[model samples]
Target: MQKIRYWVVGGEYTSTDFETLIEGTERVVGPFESRSDAERTWRYLSEDHRPQAQVRFTIAQEPQGTMTA
Candidate 1:
């Protein structure tokens, strides 16, 4: 079975979603299985890396071997 992957990131943006490389942020946990897993990790990490006023956590998903953005 093909495994889907989720990635977490943080940044400020006017309009964008599922971007591989967001302008102000880098991939935090890279790709893992499931959005829930990624969100859990993001929540834990956000404690130390709190997002600023314009920044927010984001999760992007992709199926293995398929382009997501």
Candidate 2:
């Protein structure tokens, strides 16, 4: 089975449309073992940056290869 990992990606974007991110504002936060953990971090980041209209964060998942039984 493929082991999946979660991550918190995104940061300050150039516009409200969120089509592009600023040059140095890209923020990637970790390969969490569980989606809940990633979500926790995401909530914190989002709330922390709530004052900035351009700041944003989202949860992402990726495969971490197969796991042996």
Candidate 3:
């Protein structure tokens, strides 16, 4: 299975404000199985918790095939 990394952005509302917003909330980020899953998670968090915040999902894949020796 391929490993994926998920990053949660737009949490620049200051430590105090962010803490207040995230209180009683579970993790807003995750490692999903696909790009669509990652996007969905970002959308859910942005809409329900941070409507004014800009959210984005990025996926990085290693190039296939052998490299020149």
lDDT, candidate 1, 1-69, per-residue tens: 577888886655444443444465654677877778898888876665554444467677874689545
Give me the displacement of residue 56 in model 3, in angstroms.
9.4
Residue-level lDDT tens digits of model 3 in 1-69: 335454444443424334433333334465455667777767776667554452222333333342233
Best by lDDT: 2
Q: What TM-score would every model get versus the actual structure?
A: 0.55, 0.87, 0.40
lDDT by candidate, in order shown: 0.66, 0.89, 0.47
Candidate 1 residue 65 C-alpha distance from true site, Å? 4.5
Error of 1 at 55 (Å): 2.0
| Model 3: worst 10 consecutive residues (lDDT sum) | 54-63
Please list the residue runs of candidate 3 whose C-alpha ends up more than 4 Å from where it truly belongs after superposition.
1-3, 9-12, 15-28, 51-69
User: What number of clashing residue pairs does each candidate have, in the order they appear?
Assistant: 0, 0, 0
Q: In candidate 1, list every pair of residues with a backbone clash.
A: none
